[model samples]
Target: MSSPRRVTLSPTSSAASSAGFGAGSFVVGSLGGGSSFSIRSTLSARACLDCFSPSVSAMGAPPAPRQHQSEPATRQSVQSPPIATTAVFSALVERAQTQYAKSGDRYIGYRVLGDGPIDLLALNNGSNIWIDRDDEPHWAHFDRRLSSFTRLIRFDPSGVGLSDPLGAGELPTVELWTQDALAVLNAVESEHAALLGVSDGGPVAMLLSAMYPERISALVLMNSSARIARDDDYPCGIPQHLLDRFVNTVSDPTGGEDRVDDLALLAPSLAGDPEFQLWWKTAGERSAGPTTAKALDTLATAFDVRGILPLIRVPTLVMYRLDHPFLRPGHAHYLAEHVAGAKLVELPGRDHLAYVGETEPLLDEIEEFLTGTRGGSDTERVLATILFTDIVDSTKRASTAGDRLWREQLDNHDRMAARQLQRFGGRQVKSTGDGLLATFDGPARAIQCGLAMCDGARQLGMDVRVGIHTGEVERRGTDIAGIGVHIASRVQACAEPGEVWVSRTLTDLLAGSAVTFADRGDHTLKGVPGTWQLFKVEG
Candidate 1:
């Protein structure tokens, strides 16, 4: 027997477990790969052929791998995170050989392989704690396929995974989450990289591309949604009702079977890849315990990033499975349409994982998109439901309220507008002075939110006009530009105090909704060419 090493606790037991987990015994069940399937075992292509079993062999062959599976499962030498970022970034640290940064507990995990040049970030999907198996150390198939061409960096976001624990009050919204991604990129000296996001990781990818387009070469989104809320039209996606249920479930101590199953479904591609399956299961179980429900609740109720799709400037491949139970192809379609020149491909298989399931076809598509050999395919169609809103008479209001008081009132206005936006499933762009600019996933939500905001402002003793238009817009910094923003602004200008008005585009997008709009007559505005049919918000 060897001597035990003394351990230190940094609140992220998951990361600390790296030292704690040195055991090398491998185990499997009825579904088994060949006995040669050790984490470090070197399999000849012939050996892997039989090792993966006849079923996986039929699916399609994977790319060449560098390492053998005979070696015991263990973390490769890499840096770990410090105590602070540890709470927010767990997985990266626990398995790291060294810390990325020594500054105030903020750090990220990184692993360099393949050739230099491009950096690839692998964001984490939600992995609940409870799984205890050491996966990568024992999984041969994964080590082989992913070891080529890509320099992969994986990290734990706040409050879960192997990173340190977080304060209950820390808000992990899309913006904050994207901040973590940016921090990782910056820490690793990556000027640019193609982002690959899975499940909830999709929103982070979209936001990163939007905020830092120059830094993202391309994006690969799998089984993700811009909005956490769902509608009757999209059955498989996460409905708002279901999100509420999820919040309740995550708080459970046992990490309910439903939650586990729901997560397992996210990577259905791994169902047959026992090695990967084991790794995923163990990673999730080790991260957040059953009580992490509150953290899950924070994400489920508040995570909405639909507004940033139009801001994307990098090449992208938004791939979604036809039958993904958590997030459907419709969301993927929405993403494809929103991003300026992104591509959407629907292929065979119902799995939500890119590494597992039928990956060859996916790999081929990725290769094509990344190389631009597949060509620039303008797959985006004009969607009629995006609405833009900003506060009116901001110049006068700023003058009246003065710097301090006016700033406070503007803050209040922004808060009210954002709350309404969240309720309506709208996206909040960066704030304009004394106003807010936002886009809704649906026309109904846009109209409803406009009226609500205007009315809410009245109650606060401030009069405001609301304008909304649904059309494709060019992203400018945190705000939107192009005809859509102009039309919405013009609509707001046309509105009388304490009223909401929308352009004809918004009216047409409302056809399917129970809500209706009353004609406000044709209006021509300053600098805006052509007469626009306008309507007042009505029940």
Candidate 2:
């Protein structure tokens, strides 16, 4: 009897979770005439589906079946809007045309959304910019906001998205992707423009700014890191153990689920929303298949740009969520510290996916950084929700666990706390050793995260207390310091073990949420002028 034919997927990196054969090696078994080719037959049946798939659209048209040709560069004139209104903005992108930019032997996909005063080139993190257009509400909102003051240009890297695909097994490198970006700029006839790099695109933007300073007016990096692998000098990179798991997930057949999981981590605030999750899943499937995603993941893991930070000459802004699950604030801090004159703006949210959650704050910061104004205004004060959490009887727990074990537990606790904050779209302001202070755009999420943190602490054999307040806060550089902070801290102090307390302001704001609260009566808060009413969240 002959052995059965088995297909095996293997890892391509030494840091791969499983120990296996060398990279890029695929082993296949020969089949006899008597043997049935089920896999091939199945694929043949799906050929029709593949032929009409919307994902294969290139240059604004469905690709010809089994045909390969270079798309010529094209452009469309977009009227500069005094301010991008909803109706005008919707019409612009809907009517916008996809163009081709020649780079090397391949053509890259590019699009122009506006023709405002400044030219802006947006680099997506290893995804199709055309797919982003399908996310009309989010993408349109972003484009409209940006186009109000600048000409917004977006493009897909070669071999990804709507751009020309690479030859079989061909993977793009940072240098190649950067060249594609430059080609897009050339095709658009943009002499100079500001660059906005989100996530993986950060390194490409950095490289472009460093190599072609004259072509870049400024640079903005969002939820990105300089390096992705942990080392002796770079501790912020994902650990080998985590990287291995990530690689396996990316290569799995159900990697679409992994992508959704990633979206959850990157945009926890929107993960539970059906509309957002559907959009994310559809976008991911349309962006790339498992093999391509795995290849991109491998390339990103090896990406390191620490050496080039100092070489950048353009004015730079590094913005990150303090509680981002994938990239930590330290990564942004590192960029700001090394890049001369670079300003770091730590926004209040955990979503690494730019379009989800509280994106207005990020856009405000970016607009102000790039154009010296925010939404064409100068005001910085904005409405915000504050959350404060502290460990109950933490001093005694530390004494019981001892120094070494307690330190480990504390580290775990901090990680858990940050995840909870990220889940609720909260921005971690600072850690108070035994607790954390964070800010949010809405009070409902703050209350929900506080409840989750309490539950999580209980799972770790610990007790926690939480407090929430809603008020206006002043935005400072990478931090928020105002009376709101003091009120939140005092509110937390009133909470008992395993209890979540909130000010009347927060309760009022959470009017429609399922959350319920019991009146805690009025009390005087220290260092504050008036007496305040408080409430305890009820299950």
Candidate 3:
């Protein structure tokens, strides 16, 4: 079985806590066999019922179905977790779309899974970063494990299963995959989450955990290896030539399903299981042709976690089978040795895939790791003003001019707005697709920055809106966040194109800046609590 699919706001995500997976989804479909009869749609976004009351987004003629023959599932029902507060879900979806659209090819879509404990973005380990709800019923063991936590999300990578495929050059390394994972987390707007990797997913989790230690709470590796290429002394490892050949076979969209070693090495117990093989074949085919093969070629000689090991201070558990082939037990041992305090767990039966084989012990160990200990928190906290700016009718404008001209215009817009922001003594936060987020030491500077950004963008014939608010913000590693940030975004959404809106807090903070506001009166924002009195800049 594969790991869960994902979507998060930040760490690059914070998990969703709700009854089922579709907390933010409205559409549904069915995939797999017995798994077919009983389909599990992306857990309905708990807020879908609330979205148009109001909601949320994706694109494409979704790629073909990730079909697989399946025996009746072992029928295990997972009790869902609690619902996410509006703040959390809003943050999750806002980031989900933000990240999903970044797929190297096609527009990626997502389904919310509010079934588990800690949030999990089952980053599809294939060509596309996407998920098919139809196949959910067939992966019970996967659901049960993920549902055991707070929130779990599943999605296609890019160019596979329901997602459009990109060219070979699109994804050159695991760094791209890791970036895809980060995009999903950013999509969910999560700041931290546990990393649970399986098969080819192993290296990604390790990289994410190492590169951004603060975002990950823990690490779980199943049937994964640090490296597959032979290390002179380790001849049992995958030969480089064999690795290249396998990639060619599996990734070829037109290639026959003469399944290869990577798939073969996955489930020692299930390799011979026809249903399992079909599922693997289907997952790979649906994502992108021979994509996994391309990944293997990259994986064999690409990853270098040596410098990243000791930096991984999070609690970690490595699970591997004694008889697994792709990644030998020795690699697992080597990983534990290098991962500081990581614990090595050798499963009794030799099943290369962590989702298969004897699962209780592996899960038990994971449960202990997550619930038993906490890591050191060097998180810094602060108070500041958060702002969100967006271009109005940006898509239309981009479409009007085509990619080349539109890109040039967009770059100019970014530069001009950034220049004004610096002049106003404001800190540039981040960009929102075609928009921007910024911070200010005072409300006056924030308002001035917002107004200037709108005016500057206007030069490019791009009308934009701005929103600002002041409140307590927690600085987690390098990102700034809080309810204040969410409120600021909503306030921006409320503004008319070209207008700069400010939360009451901002109005109060800017006693010195030459900015005036016309009260729009108190109104309720989607997902935010209570009624807020927003003011529009009259200047």
Candidate 4:
């Protein structure tokens, strides 16, 4: 193997800049021998990989990314929110619009999110879908952490999810999957990127890295292996009889009806959780059908990337949970030993899935490996829905009623609000003088509570304006503070008298709920960084 030649990709087009990618040069390299050259070229009118033009140079090491951090927050009251169902979560967090990358005659579905410096392409195991990912909080949080340090690209492999399914009698292969990945890369004009492969997706990442070293900057393999099936020389692989049994299980025509066994093997920690089980069954069925699942599984058993493992020349990180039943520590050991300069990190857990159990430690390792910093902070942050309510014209109402009468009205209002908060499972953060601030685990509950406040206020001969927004809030002891808190406050200020107004984030989470919303249009919230789309909760 020759010294890997470096390639530099510069995004000079206005379209690229507008898409949140900064204008600059980034280094990447190929393992194969190639003379260094520079060319400013636009992609031709191809059916599949149409996108911006990119200028390439000899690949080299990528630049270090800038440090990113969350804002500090003060806390007043704290309580954990209840676990929500998938139907509610899907609408809570907004989704990235799905786009297609043409690979040969077939279309590959992909989506881009975050604007971090490095482009990290997530190659999921064939059984997962991008749209269904938001259904789980852990998975969504994992993606957000990755995106916080890199521009995250997620896509469906050929014949899975939103991508065109494989033809009848056709089989899936690593080479074909590699093409699907490359098409997505071209579609986004990302000449260089780090690859994060989970489960069976790891083999494809290894092959792509070895085959086109210039395009790959780094490789991270999580709970994956070079080859899965056992043979005489590879005693660590799954035995033939067990592999056959697993294949037969997935090929069952009953589909998602009985996935408990599958969930147990994949994520034992979450197997007992009914909500997680429902999401697993639904996401699996939506991800791939019985035939496709079997095909992917059959192909996976045949995957043997050991021959190309030594050919990989880029920075590599091999991560595996120590007790993952099937993936096991041996696979990570094999990968770390074979791949040159590979760093192996063993995490302690029983779940094979990356999103299950304690995930922050895994995320912490990946962040430190890629960015040279753990970026840990003193304050804790979590995803939550913030609710702000204010009594309309409080001063005037007080003047009309006098101090004693106004005090009585305030007491009645507080009692009413407390009852609604308790009923909805919300924690009141503090009193906002004329109103109150609270937080909920789910947006649907927050909105419902806000509406309850409005109705309760009307009974007290007072009007109340309520606002709600969902985002990452910083926990500071007994209070919560962050940009998320500020956004909710501004949203409340924008509400009309006796109306319950919510940020678009709230409405998205409540999409399939019985509640309906009328668009209040986009407004530039005071103290907030961007123009937020607001909506009114219909009575």
lDDT of 3 by residue, 188-258 (tens): 55556577776556666776665555566677776666655555754435555555544454344453434
Q: How many backbone clashes does candidate 1 have?
A: 36
Q: All candidates' TM-scores?
A: 0.51, 0.52, 0.49, 0.53
Tens digits of per-residue lDDT for model 1, 409-444: 877887888788888677887665656677754455
Pairs of colliding residues, candidate 2: none
C-alpha lDDT of all candidate models, in order: 0.50, 0.62, 0.54, 0.64
Which prediction has more favorable lDDT, 1 or 3? Answer: 3
In angstroms, the error of model 1 at 429 is 16
Q: Quick one: RMSD of model 4? A: 23.5
Best by TM-score: 4
- Candidate 2's C-alpha runs over 4 A off are 1-89, 126-128, 254-260, 373-539
- The TM-score obtained by model 1 is 0.51
Could you give me the TM-score of model 3 versus the true structure?
A: 0.49
The reply for model 4, stretches above 4 Å from the true place, is 1-95, 127-130, 255-260, 373-539
lDDT of 2 by residue, 1-539 (tens): 11212112111111111111111101010001000000101112122222212222210111222211122112222222132344656566675688898987898887777655555677664444563454546656656776655556777776567888877756656656767777777776665546677776777777666655555666777777777666788766666655655555534554233222454445567556676556555665666666666666655655676755666656666777766655655677788788876666666666666765556666655555554421111135444678999999989999998999999988988999989987877899889999998987456668889999999999988988998876646679878877878898899999889999998765543432346799999889999889999999995
Report the alpha-carbon TM-score of model 4 versus the true structure: 0.53
- Please report how far candidate 4 places residue 403 from its true position, in Å: 99
lDDT comparison, 2 vs 4, better candidate = 4
Better of 2 and 3 by lDDT: 2
